[model samples]
Target: MSRAEVKQLIGVKDVARIVLGWGAFAALLILHPLLEPPVPAPVLVIALAVIVAVILVCAFGVVTQAEALAHRLGDPYGSLVLTLSIVLIEVILISAVMLGPGEHATIARDSVMAVAMIILNLVIGLALLLGGMRHRGMAHNRTGTSAYLSMLVVLVALAFGLPALIGVDGSYATAQEIPIIILTLVLYAFFLFRQMGAQAGDFTEVDTRSPQRSPREERTGIRQVLAAHRAEVIVRLALLVVTVIPIVLLSHDMAALLDDGLGRLGAPVALAGVLIAGIVFLPESITAVRAALGGEVQRVVNLCHGALVSTVGLTIPAVLVIGIATGQTVVLAESPANLLMLGVTLLLSVTTFAAKRVTAMHGAAHLVTFAIYVVVLFS
Candidate 1:
């Protein structure tokens, strides 16, 4: 390959990310014995920090490539790729935590709840606040946003609330688990079909009064752009997979270290869930904020709302299957307090998206709810 081809395939920063990600994974494999229990406090702390930093780097790399793919695919499909990639990371982390050496029956529940609170309340709150302050009120597609929320309400209720109401000891029976898993997957599949098919237009920004470009023109533009960058798409997709593999392989080590470190420090168990959610969503959170600030309110909505939907939709079934297969108890129900918080968050989300334009006040309301979630988490 020519130098320019090599350069396009992997930039200097991409090289750094690949090296750090895979290098960390290789080092962890070689040094696995040292990470065992009774290690020195300093060593444990250093290991945790290094693993987290590497994971973050790999995560950012994944986001960069996913964004490139999203730009190529356009709107709902592009957003789907981005959200699914992040959600894939989330599933890996959650699975690592659950399968790691611990009685973490509730890790899945805690993580899913954390993702919802973080994305719906915290991330969206900040995006709306910043975007609204600059633009007075940010406009988004009410139809698409509403569809996302409608699915979220049912899925959240089924995954979190209904389990508490019906399951014995905060978990479903084997029979119940199979049906619920199928239901969640089927619902999400149907939603994806509509979002990408007949209702695809609902996900994009459209100014009916003063149109910028016709649908045909927009389609032509996307095609031309995709054609121009076909080679880049292939390169980025390859890199995205390369970058993600390290994070997946390294996650088990990270999980072991995190469990040990947090146990030593006597931190709240839920804090692990929060950290996982934060790590998994950090890149997407930043992207959403930038999109909001750039006046792409619908893009912000797609990123934030779409992420949580994907999180709950995909993570629950995954953990449940793992639990069934491994004989681990996976908890899906939330505590009374968390359930109440989840209810409030869902209701608040409906209200926020019901409007044609979102303002700072809407953002403030969501932030207040998120603040309460944090307080509840620590207390």
Candidate 2:
């Protein structure tokens, strides 16, 4: 009814993202026949560029809406919403590729590994580096960070490491996959229970020495905020879902183009995974870095570590189930180089978070490790 209300409901940029994202999806559907293979190289390049651009726009739109909801929801819950929204897009993209007409047995594995490396090392590294430089040192909830890392260690080992050791090839047997799907889901469910219930405080920023709000008071405050912005929250939530649909619909087209383009270019196969990971997480990475710079170190941890946890906990099972249903052979094992990188990353993360305060020096270590990952990727 008022100017402020109108502005809060939706902005010009939000409308632009929705229109462009859907417009691109519509164009792809109509021009599908013409865009099919044996197409001209120039056309393929142009199509890929346009589609990727639109997807990026939609991704940022998702971030915008997620952040709005997050502000209303508060920490942990807010971060969870943002993390899950991004991961949903990721899972959709991976599933689209796996279901497409190709032997993409390892797309899941590649994408998951890429996500881990990018989020854990590259994004977190930059966040801490910038935050530390600006603030000298940043404080975060050690218990929360430790919980995330511990769960990550177990999930990463189960998803990427153990398969290589035990499977005849590079994946679990059909029998093994069944139980794994259940176990992974169960563990993640338990984690959700603790994270949202009894242990929720661990995931939030709190001054331990200072007095704190009672949980009931905190809940009441959050409720008041949400109630006041109910209309805005609903609008943003709807827009977030609307924006994500186009990305999901366009993923098949993108995957086909990507596979063909890479084959022609002779680029490394792993690069496809890297690109997908980058696209899905790029917005969140920016958000995390901003949080770090603002000295919201715990929020940064929630965005980065929380994201990877969901990526592994949810994605592995989704792909495994997809593999089982489609009769596709899904490979989950990492090469020796990647396995070593994972081990080092987990160890380094533990050491970094164990400290009382995170400093620029810790960030440097992470960046160096990420550099090695880049080298290994290209080499």
Candidate 3:
């Protein structure tokens, strides 16, 4: 395709990824000589980190563009796009590692657990704690919160809990997984229908107290704003896909580097999972935190719980299919220790949200659970 034709397809936001993709390519050229040499641990770490930083920049661009689109699209759809973009990143990252030569049977499981831990315990906790400190207790819809919590609890139990209680084929059975995968997708679709379709005015509703638009935005007019959002969505969506291809392409190298690096350091084998989890979770972490601080705990819940549900709801099916097609083993259960923490964290989260208001102390409790997760990760 001619640059002119391609140029017509992209907007200002797409320029960010275009510029970054080129910069990353140039950086790789510069690093060719360095990467060719016998790579040292520190040197390899630096090299990998640089590459990761570039990928992260692309991801952040996607998040920014998606955030704008969310503002324009409105909740349910907007929130769906926001969380799905982050979820897509997580999926891409994990799929890359899983499909690589690394023998990480549990990467999918660990990554899901990590995302849930980070969002529920860390992000949710911080949002509530900080917001509560300022507002004491912000009123939310108890029934709505409870509905989301109910689905989440059932899904988590089915995905993580039942997997632990049952095993087959020396690992997670393809037969078993395929049904769960289908059920997961079907159930999640039904949940979305309930949330966005039937129950739109109830639990899944957006905050009526939406912040006012800027004077500039007000003058832009609905048609103009939608046109801009549409253009941006098209351009950035393409760019986001283009940007992620490289991240996936480079996953083999990243997998090798991480495997060797972590192995050499005598670190926990799970550190590789943590690295991917941390990288993928970075954008949502910022958004979730911001939602909390803005007295938008519902937004925070939507982002956090939406992420958690998407992780288990969507990722399991995708990962299972990949694992089965590639003839690779897949593991889905957490350690007993992690399972305990996850159960308690889920329990605490639902309990806290049962009230029409959440307090800072509730946030602190979740953070404590997060701390415990970290300690378990290393120990």
Candidate 4:
């Protein structure tokens, strides 16, 4: 094979994912005796690093491969593919960790909140800043952003706020959590029907237009386009499974390390949530940033808001169900400070996206908010 052909056949991302997954898995298994109680603090730290690295690599591989498939599918569908892929990864990883050998009542809450923070502030701010530098400012679909925010505000309240208000015990009662889960599902389902079905055009367009892709992505796109439908379907289906297993496997080890590491250092419990959020958000974060740089502010909006909404929408229900199945008490309530941050975030999203255009000033505001979130996380 020519060098180019060889490169195509031997995917660095794919191979890295496989190696990291197996390596992490094998390491964890082999070190199980050492990993038991009184485990050296250094060993725990090293385990944390290796497992998180493996999971992160697999995540990026999943995103890269999914983006290629999304390219073939096209928007609405393409965007759906991307958002759902990230949600699936989050669900798998979170579920794995939650089901593992410890209690993690707040993983879902922290992760969803982290996603909301990342989406509304960091991703949006960076996108606006980067897109402005590239194209002097970018325009987004106000209608979709407005609608998304409308649902987002309500959903955030329902998921994170409602629990604190009505719960009987320290956390929510099954009674309270179940209702919130149902409400979130119904609202999100309606939003999907409207966006993907009734008035899909109101949403922003994805800019996977050929001219924007890299030479390799372009060639892959061409191959995807020319391939028989059956072959393409088989490839995507196969790749999806291969990419996800590693993340699910590594999540437990990563969770144990985070719990151990944070506990050892006397860090705030919320820090664990931030780490979970960052890891799960990394894959989608890349695509959103790329969309912003490509001058597709609308796609960036879709990616950011879609992720925020879906993280709340899908995750709440999934977490609730997991709680029911496992007898785990899932807590969605944020601390007072975090609740304030969320309120500010939702409020700002309402006003920022109320307009049709976004600029550097908007990006700066977002970055400032993101800085506050980080500061609070550390403090």
Candidate 5:
């Protein structure tokens, strides 16, 4: 075939592509059990490698569609959807893994810590590094960055520290945890309504990292698009939900397999924490790299930071509610690696904000930090 034909073939698609992509992945996960000890080591390795690659490709599609939907709706709340999607995946995996009979206090702790490192190193790291490199000297609404940082500090402290302080004293069954959970949800709701809703104008935080547009009165283009394409929107929404279910189920099983695999390989339990982090972050990592390359740094910031916030703000409440309702308590306690990662993340976040520009060097630094996280996490 001609080069053009090959390119066309590469882009070729219909429901069949989606089905094959999703179905093959689903089948691998289902049949993973059948690929037993009898299978040759080399063959099993190749098969597992192929499965991971396929899953990564599917993740790309999932993230791309999510980005498309967000663009169609415009950002802010649209970004919320993308962030929540990932957070839901994390919560599902974490909850599912924890459901198995072991002390998952470390799982909760490490998952949150893993997320913190991803946000600080990968997300904020790229943002500052690339934005600084491109702009050399960029400026943002310091107030905005500071405010976000402050909220982040409080949120992290509460989410991670509170469990140790409060302890699962069975008050989880009483009204005690209720008030705390309610307060947590209320704070998130306030920010959602204030920033993305009617009060958005009151907070003018320009992301110096991104390109600027005309300060004209905002238009309702997005609203019109969403209204006109209601049916398509509904279809996409339904597809998102449909896609999520299998991923969640597969992730749950994947976590289990990962645990067994780690034991077989003599891997640290922290490896499982890292895997949970990887599964949840697979989508955001793709989007972040793309946004940075596309020169949409502000969007990148919004996505990365916004995702961090949502993971803590949104996922915390949902998981807490689940735990409360199901008579399980999901608190933050675990391996020392969790605290180590958290400290690193917090320090990086503060440095990024204080010095509002990022360079390729900075990006490189963040990547190095990420490497450290991987080493420590795996060690």
Candidate 6:
């Protein structure tokens, strides 16, 4: 009955809701692969429904974690982690599927393009647009934004555009691609280290003016916080790993089934791309949507812009190397529709950010652009 007890009850209730939601989602995800049609047909439908539910739940968990993790790890890499996690999942799935010898090099190209187009058109575009609408020109350090965007352009151009323009013949041994791949990866690694380690401040909007604390001060502070919290960071990370592994397995199964199902159903092939994007982007998409609803444009800007940069700059290069090495070729060469989509995405992003600020009108404009993309894909 006491006030402290009352507050504790409310806190526990909120935590319960989150845990239950995620737990239910995890359950469905776990059950998805086990629900093969050797079982009754009606039962299979029920299982698919559960799979859908789990996807929604997992999406919720992703967005919730994004806010919390971003606070802890700092933007934009904190946000980068969300998108990166999804991209990593996709790469793992594609790599697994492409383990065979007959896989096309263009598989890598198509996937990269698919992911890029989805991220650019829907995830990044609308997040920024809606966030801009809410904030009416949310402020991000223009310098950092420009740098991130520029690097993204160059990386995508090199990875996707170059391959297309050159019309690389299958006759060229993948061994020839290895050196270029290594050089690109090494360059990326160098930039990553510099960005995260010594120059982390260069990417931030917040200016931390406090003098550097001693190692002891930092350690003591960390110790106190860890001591105060019952759950450790390691525990959360382990849970994330545990939860992620099953989801990844289930995602692979679902990807194969969905591909078959959509093809049999006479669904547009782009639906396959959309489904892939849905699984990979569930986390980032939910965050942007929630931020839009909440009228938090700055968070939206950080999520969308950061996701775009990470998808193209990091994901594309990583996959290019993986595809070449694994002989899967998940790059952008498979689908011309995907190439057109990527071009539209790049054009929209360049124009959207060219002003260095965004408005609600811009958000509406981007939504219209996204509508066109969907129409074109389905048509």
Best by lDDT: 2
**Among all windows of ten consecutive residues in candidate 2, which has the lowest summed lDDT?**
212-221
Error of 5 at 100 (Å): 7.0
Instruction: Give the per-residue lDDT digits (tens) of candidate 6, residues 304-339.
Output: 655655555555555556666665544454346555
Checking candidate 5 for backbone clashes, the offending pairs are 106-334, 128-358, 129-358, 129-359, 132-358
Residue 350 alpha-carbon offset, candidate 1, angstroms = 1.2
| Candidate models: Cα lDDT each | 0.82, 0.85, 0.71, 0.74, 0.61, 0.57
Q: Which regions of candidate 2 are displaced past 4 Å?
A: 1-7, 33-45, 208-210, 214-224, 247-252, 260-265
Which TM-score value belongs to model 4? Answer: 0.81
- List model 1 lDDT by residue over 1-379, tens digit each: 4578969768889989999998998899899898888778899889878888898888888878777777677787667767877688768777876787879898778778888989999999999999999999888888889999999999999999888888989899998999999999999989977776667777886466875554566566657866887677667777877887777566545766777777777877677767666666776787788778888889888888888888888899999988998998888888899999999999999988889899989999999999998889778
Q: Ten residues in a row with the worst lDDT in model 5?
A: 212-221
TM per candidate comes to 0.87, 0.89, 0.79, 0.81, 0.78, 0.74
Clashes of 6: 11
**Candidate 2 residues 88-180, lDDT tens each?**
877877787788897988878888899899988999999999999999998888998999998999999999998998885898999999999
* TM-score (C-alpha, index-matched) for candidate 3: 0.79
How far is each candidate from the true structure, as Cα RMSD in Å?
A: 3.1, 2.7, 5.6, 5.7, 5.6, 5.8
Model 5 spans with C-alpha error above 4 angstroms = 1-17, 29-32, 35-40, 93-106, 126-147, 166-176, 199-222, 228-232, 235-249, 334-337
Model 4: per-residue Cα lDDT over 1-379, one tens digit each: 3467545644776777777777778878888777775557888877777777777777777677666765665444456666776677677777877888888888788778887887899888888888878888676767767888888889888878877778744367877767777888999999987776545656745333523444355445435654645455446645655766666556645655677778878887777766766666666677777877878777777777887888788888888889988999888888888899999988887777776577877888888998999888877
TM-score order, best first, reads 2, 1, 4, 3, 5, 6
Q: Which stretches of candidate 1 lie over 4 Å from their true place?
A: 1-3, 92-104, 206-229, 245-252, 260-266, 325-328
Worst 10 residues of 3 by lDDT: 214-223
Residue pairs that clash (backbone atoms under 3 angstroms), model 1: none
Can you write out model 3's per-residue Cα lDDT over 292-352, one digit (the tens) per residue? 6777777777777887888888788878889889998888877789889889988998889
